[model samples]
Target: MRAMVIEENGGPEVLRPSEVPDPVPGPGEVVVDVTARGVNFIDIYQRSGLYEVPLPFVPGMEAAGVVTAVGEGVEDLSAGQRVGWAMAPGAYAERAAVKASLVVPVPDGVSDEQAAALLLQGMTAHSLTHSVHPVSEGETVLVHAAAGGTGLLLTQLAKARGARVIGTVSTEAKERIAREAGADEVVRYTETPVAEAVRELTGGEGVAAVYDGVGRDTFDAGLASLRPRGVLVLFGQSSGPVAPVDPQRLNAAGSVYLTRPSLAHFVADRQELLGRAGDLFSLLAQGRLDVRIGGRYPLADAGRAHTDLASRRTSGKLLLV
Candidate 1:
């Protein structure tokens, strides 16, 4: 099988396309003939050595495709079933051997590319809006990177949960994208000071919570956008890692609650994983959530995908196939 392998973590060039041995399924595992792989910030961080993986790693975390073979002890899933995962690794290849426990059957109405795009970003949106803050009517929330992959999905999900979403983006193009995703307000952070704009929109009261992913550039501003007892969920460090700050900042900033969340903790068990994937795909199937696959590159073009994501030059979901 052809795979993009990283001998050592660095830039996109470190991801070298090479021919590797075909994956074989072990007990409780399944070999998927991968058709599409999702590009995410974590992939960029892993490739850049920020989020270190052992040397010689495959650089993708999510993908969707056919079940070419099923391992022992796996039932109810057979060869040729279409499936996707939120936590599987080594997906940037022709095939991946994943524990069957982690894979979910793709819904009938969703295409393969859409499945690849939505699995991670959609599930994150689901977990965050449904768990982290659980948006409700008469509540307000702010989403950073509102035009990015997770941001767009989170925007729709928050609105679906009945919260008014105020989103921050870097450009006019992104502003349109955020608005189309159901954000009631969009702030061009590149033009206006995002915090000030958010406060102005909220009548200077602030939001119920801020779901921040643009870490260093937006962390302080995100904290400032929240109301008393609001929560700041900092999930990704897109612009950069936030500097160490005083704990008093949260208290002084309105008794805010801060959480650094990751998908791993949210899908800690098979049941949780299945539940999240289920809800996400169901929403997509039902036309309630839109997982726009914004970009696609061939399997060998994984490097370009990483470059685009890290540079913040792409929006919605990116896929490698």
Candidate 2:
């Protein structure tokens, strides 16, 4: 199998394509003949040493493919079944050996690329809107990087829940994308203060919650963009890791709630994993959700995918095919 392996983390160049041994399924595991793999910011973090992992490891966390082999104790899933998984490491390869618990059935209508693209970002968006803060009807929320993969999905999900969405983007083009995703208001945060813009959009009331994936650069603005007792869900640190926050600051900022949630914690069990993925798949099958795939790289071009993502040059999802 040809895999993207990182012996030491530093930059995008560190992602080297090499021939590696094909994965073998252990007990309760299944080997997938990967057709597509999703490239995410977490992969960048791991490649850059911001999120530490064991050396000489494959870099992807999400992928969709046909099951080639099923290990002992795995009864529900069988060989040749189409499946997808998120938060399962070693996916940047031709085959991925995944725990049966992490694999979710890929519906008939969704393509392998779509399945790979939807699972991680889609479920993250779902968990953020439906669980982290639970957006309510007619309420307003703020989403940072509103044109990115998770951003667009999060915006649409929030709108579906009837929450008014205010999105922040770096360019006018992204503003248009955000609006298309159902954002009620879009602002170029590069030109204006994000908190001030959100406050003005909500008539100075701020929003019910702020879904922030760009940490450090957007942390303070996201916190300040919330109303009294409103929550700030910091799910990623694309810009950089946020510094240690002072709880006193939270008290002063209208008693705002702060949380850093991960997909792993949200889908700790098989039931929760399937539930989230199923909801996203249902929405996709019904044509209610539009997943924009910005780029597709061959396994050999995994390094370029990382470079583009880190530079914020791509919108929607990037996939390895």
Q: Which candidate has the highest lDDT of all?
A: 2
RMSD of each: 1.0, 0.8
Global lDDT of each candidate:
0.89, 0.92
- lDDT tens per residue, model 2, 200-300: 88889988899999999999999889899999999999999999999999999899999999989899988999999999999999999999999999988
Each model's backbone clash number:
0, 0
Where is the poorest 10-residue window by lDDT in model 1? 277-286
TM-score attained by model 1: 0.98
After superposition, the stretches of candidate 2 with alpha carbons farther than 4 Å from their true spots are none
Q: Write the per-residue lDDT of candidate 1 for residues 270-321, one digit (tens) a residue.
A: 8898898888878888888888778889988889888888888788989997
Top TM-score: which candidate number? 2
